[model samples]
Target: MTTASSTSSESSQERYQHALMNTFGAPKLILTRGQGARVWDEDGKEYVDLLGGIAVNALGHGHPALVKAVAEQLSTLGHISNFFASGPQIQLAEKLISLLQPASGVGSRPAKVFFTNSGTEANEAAFKLTRRTGRTHLVAMKSSFHGRTMGALALTSKEAYRAPFEPLPGDVTFVEYGDAAALAAAVTDETAAIVVEPLQGEAGVVVPPADFLAKARAIADEHGALLWLDEVQTGMGRTGAWFAHTASGATPDIVTLAKGLGGGFPIGACIGLGDAADLLQRGNHGSTFAGNPPACAAALAVIATIETEGLLERATMVGEKLRDGLAADPRVTAVTGEGLLIGVVTTVDTAKIAAAALAQGFIVNNATPDRIRLAPPLVLTDEDVAAFLAAWPTILDAAEALA
Candidate 1:
């Protein structure tokens, strides 16, 4: 007789293969459960989670606050659609507004927000919001990744991601990332918006110069183009702050967020601060699951946890340790990022290093051939950091020797 667990396990693989299309290839491992930065595969292999669901699991899996909020909200009020708003929806917006402070100037004004189900949807909303300005021209950075949607894909610069689905929304210009002068030249009065990721996450966490954002702001202002900051990966306390653009002292007209916003639950916000807020109106846009109760509740829980637990400060402290320790290893030559969001450059093959680390019971990711990204849960413990650091050398040795 087939045991229930055995039957369920085998059925999971068979059903997934039979029903699901080949997109991301086959699953790495059939993950059964997870908690607090650790996950057990279907085979019951325990692995320390260092990737944190590609930086989306800010609090890790099965976090009590996240679980409780989601469960309670779902039990109470699940999906009300876009016709009416819920308390969690309003409260979460107000909370985000408070987090994303408004700018003061002659035309400067408080920001407004739009909610969506994922990072790509958030970008899609922002993409449409940019059009409300009447100008259709936009300047995006080369190597930028906005989203997978048609509108967002147009703004994205990768030929590989865009070529198969051309010709994308037209009137968008691609500028060299991190080049202040190039950005200045690309953005003009006719341009509706200038979109940038303060730290390019999908491009391997590439941080621009200190003044790059400032320069973008200046150029955008000079041409009357809105400065749109896509903080999907860099915001929500990932870089030791609420927003990566905070260092520039230049407030963006638009900011889009997701990934870690709901601590694993799907939620995204497109904040239109000041005049940018006025751009999108009642008839302009909408989403059914945009700001629903359960999603908002999950997001509120995440923000509340981050604040109450002092995870922001903790992220800064522990991030420095992880970055510095990894840098000490000869294979890891450089480390870039602040707080828990880190990118490591290795002299060794990143894929081999990632596989070796996984074999050694750690979970990190090879963002590229030479870069590994670490966005462990903000709740990642100090002990995990120490354990991973200790295993770093052996992981590298195994990968190198095997190669």
Candidate 2:
């Protein structure tokens, strides 16, 4: 029997229906276990996790260091309120400061970080910080997915998602992404910030032009607006580097991150550099779980593992193979993105392709009707890449037939 079929056979679907909320739709599968870049359904069938828990699991499931760090830290000190800071918190803040100022205007200015429990919360904090700029108007790009919170949602451009949560924190403008002209036209002296994603993830791995970020920086500087890059989906070595904006050499006023930050342990941060650092005064923001020691320890472990294991270079090499291999198929019209974050295009529906892959023991996401996104772990080996490449044509063939 198929893995998915056997999972359904073994799990008590009724229990989930009775216990869980209707949000997030029905359970995709009763996942029982995971290790490395693969996971097992309750029925003991395994599949490669190419999506990496929506790009959250940087080291994949059950990395020794990550597991031990969380276990040891939690045992040492479970949860300390933000009222008192821990060693891990201070260490992580220092690490982020060093990472954020790779090459700065004045030899990497001192920065401050505000922690949060998730990407959305990190963004919400940054949103509030922008308000402390004493301006209300903010601008964001089309097809960008920031977060679900009302403040972040106001900056996100999807009409379908935002309409339901209408009357969100207002005075936000939506402009065409990758179009420098539109961005220049939007920003004014009254604008608080111009938030952007270095590489649009939910928009099907859409990468803007190399100079687009530099252009945004110029406009933000011209208008005295804070240039914020929502690195939630694209930061922390996901793009084969520390931060996606680093390559552009644009020192953003604010940078918000999550997803791969804690390597799946649930930690997010909003980093403000230079003058932007002190905008949010005392009592500006707070979170119960934000700089808790355990989470900070988890994030530190992820950063250490990436450095010790050389996963950043590994990601670049493996991603090149995956990108080139997927593009070889005639069915795939185009391929875009760097590192493990990839988006594949084809004439067929991405939903059908995703379904076909799932039936064949591969998990992926249909980012759009015609685009499939692949964000496997940075630790994905050459063998894993080979296995997926071998399975690619078949997956596409089945998708074509289904379509």
**lDDT score at residue 55, model 1, on the 0-100 scale:** 79
Query: Cα lDDT for residue 345, model 2?
Result: 89
Tell me, by lDDT, which candidate is best: 2
Across residues 36-149, which tens digit of lDDT does each residue of candidate 2 receive?
Answer: 999998777789999999999999999999999999999999898878989999999999888878733425686899999999999999999999989999999999999999
Please identify model 1 stretches exceeding 4 Å from their true place.
1-15, 102-108
**How far out, in Å, is residue 396 in model 1?**
1.0
Steric clash pairs (candidate 1): 109-274, 110-274, 111-273
Instruction: For each candidate, give its TM-score against the true structure.
Output: 0.95, 0.97
Model number with the top TM-score: 2
What is the model-wide C-alpha lDDT for candidate 2? Answer: 0.90
User: All predictions: root-mean-square deviation over Cα?
Assistant: 2.6, 1.8
